[model samples]
Target: MITKDVRNWLGALTFLISLCLSGCQSGNAPASSPIETNRSLAPQRVDIRGSILSSQYSDGQVILEVERLSPSPDSRYDRAYVLVLPTAQMVDSEGLSVSISELRPGQNVAILLRAGGQGNRTGIGVARKLWIEDRF
Candidate 1:
């Protein structure tokens, strides 16, 4: 025959143990785990230093001949990349805002692009930012 006080204490201890077990089995990874740092879950951004091959402001597009300056060189980046510039922020060497029409062929440039996806093998990407590295 257990006393009332002992029963209450056992019940409370059982509740706490169950609570702790439930918390440990919640199935969430720790903050610093590799799962939490998976790159695929984040937006992929590519940066390239290249020369402008051509531009069509009316069509809001620019063709860049990649020089493969960042993220290590890869054969995939050896070709020209067609960058869509409709919403891109372009700046000149002086850091002043500019337009696609102001860009010229043969001008050195640094571009930040958002990777379209794995199925996009045509080298077409959306330009997030473009910096004209040469002064006209």
Candidate 2:
């Protein structure tokens, strides 16, 4: 007969398995080739310095025009125009304050981006963090 402890353990194990399987389903089509399936999950850090081309706080994203920056190996994104997302830990360049309204268009500043979201159907480079320079 199964003990109470054994039954609880099986329930927990099933929950964990389900959680892992959910991550596998990204709702995108399967990779066409094996090479396409293998993508580095290493998070990349990119620093961009330029003027803000546009800012959309309502949409929770920002677009900046790069004036001077290094090229990224990921060909899925355009280095000239970058999309910035506001994370919960998002802060200013000083790293003391967290304010999304401080960002405005036509302001010259530097942005630090932590790259993510590749090979999951959305190959766009998503920023995991942002460090906005003091300009608003």
TM-score of each: 0.48, 0.39
What is the C-alpha local distance difference test score of candidate 2? 0.51
Writing each residue's lDDT as its tens digit, candidate 1 over 1-136 gives: 5698899999999999999988888756565644233311212334555566656554656555545433434224433465656578877655578876777777766666676312233355567777666422
Off by over 4 Å in 2: 1-45, 69-79, 116-124, 134-136
Q: List the residue pairs that clash in candidate 2.
A: none
Instruction: Give the TM-score (vs. native) of candidate 2.
Output: 0.39
Task: Evaluate candidate 2 by giving its C-alpha RMSD to the native, one decimal.
Answer: 14.0
The residue ranges of model 1 lying beyond 4 angstroms of the native Cα positions read 1-46, 60-76, 116-122
Which of the numbered candidates is closest to the native, going by highest TM-score? 1
Residue range 82-134, candidate 2, lDDT tens digits: 56666634555444555567767765444444554333322334445554544
Q: Relative to the true structure, how large is the alpha-carbon lDDT of every model?
A: 0.58, 0.51
